[model samples]
Target: MMNHMKGPKGYETEGPRLIFEKKLTKTNIRPDQSRLLMPFKSLIRNDFLRPGIGAILVDQRNVKVGLMLTRWDMKKNSGGGTLNYALTCGSNDIVKGNRLKKDDDISFWSFRCHNVICFALVLPP
Candidate 1:
C-alpha cells in the first residue's frame, strides 16, 4: 500500500523550505508597516499564500508565506511626527501548534536581512 501524495510536495521529514519573516518597521517615524503589511495582507486577501519564495510550496508547518520587499502601500507621514503604529509581533519565531491559539502567535525571521519578516497561520482563510 502506497502512502505518498503527488505533484511536487515535500514531506516534513525532508525539512522545511519555508521560515518566518521579519519586521521592517522604522523607529519613531511611520504610521504603519505598509510594505510589510501590504504583501502580508495581499497574501491573506488572496489564496496565493504558500510556504516558499519560488513557485513550488512545501508541506511543512515550519514554512512561511512571504515578505514585502517594496513599499506598495499608500501611507505617508505629512509631518513625520510620532505616527500611529499598530503592529504586534507576539512571541519569537516559534509556532506551538497546541500551546496557544494560532492567531495569537506571530513568527518572524530574516533570510539574510530582507528588511522584514513574519509567519502565517497554520490554517488558511
Candidate 2:
C-alpha cells in the first residue's frame, strides 16, 4: 500500500522570505563584538514585535549568517548590575554562534577594515 504525508504549504514557504525583507535593517557591524542590545530593542519595538514580524541577522557584508526568532530573557549581573541579554541564533553563522561564545572579551571588527553588515527582520504577511 502507498502512503502520503502532509507537507509545508504556501505561507510556510513564503514566511521566511517576507520576514527577511521587512523586519531588520542592514548594519556595518560584526556579529562577534558588537553590543546589540540597544539596536535589537529598537528593531523589535519598531519592526518585529509588531503584530506579525520576523527577523534575521546578517554579516558585515550583507550576507545572512544567523536568525533571531524569539526574545528569551535579560538578566542583571551582580557585578555593576551589567545587563546580559540572551537571544536565539537559529543559523550556523560561526561568528555569531560558536565564535562569539568562545571568548568572553568583546572584540569589535572595524567596518572599513572588515565588512559592512546588516540584518533583515521582515514583517509577516
Candidate 3:
C-alpha cells in the first residue's frame, strides 16, 4: 500500500511536486493522469480579453487537461473577487481524483483584458 505521511499544517505529503520538479519536456501524459502543460504564445495572449478563450491547465505532456471557469472570475478581487491569481488544473477523472494534495510549482501564462500577456511561475499552497 502507498504510505502517506502528513506534512506541515497546510501541506500534502505526495502532491503535484513531480510536475514542478520535472523539466518542461514533451512527455506522453494521459488525460487520466496528473500532468501539466505550457501554453503557446498566441494562446496565452488571447486568454485575457476573450473569456471564451478560457483558462487552460496543462500536464507534463504539454497537453491541456482542464479549463478554468468560475474560478477565474473568483480571482478578480474588485468586487467580491478573491483578487488572487487565477490558476487552474484540468484533467480527467483519474487525474482529478488524484489532485495536488500539497503545494507544488506551476507555470502559468495568460492575457489581461488589456491584451497584455502575463506570465507567472508560482508554487500553489
**Candidate achieving the largest TM-score:** 3
Over the stretch 1-125, how does candidate 1's per-residue lDDT look in tens digits? 01111213342322222333333334212323222232444232223233323221112354433332332233557843321212223222212222333233233211221222233333221
Give the whole-model CA lDDT for all candidates, comma-separated: 0.27, 0.30, 0.32
Off by over 4 Å in 1: 1-68, 72-78, 81-103, 112-125
Q: How accurate is candidate 2 locally (lDDT)?
A: 0.30
Query: Looking at model 1, which ten-residue stretch has the lowest summed lDDT?
Result: 1-10
Model 2, residue 42: displacement in angstroms? 7.0
**Better-scoring candidate (lDDT), 2 or 3:** 3
Candidate 3, overall lDDT?
0.32
In model 1, state the lDDT of residue 95. Answer: 26
**Predicted candidate 3 versus true structure: per-residue lDDT over 1-125, tens digit per residue:** 11111223444333222212322332313454333433222132333333323443433333433454322333334655432222234434313343433333344433222222222233344
Measured by lDDT, the strongest candidate is: 3
**TM-score of model 3 relative to the true fold?**
0.29
Off by over 4 Å in 2: 1-54, 75-87, 90-125
Which regions of candidate 3 are displaced past 4 Å?
Answer: 1-52, 69-81, 84-99, 110-125
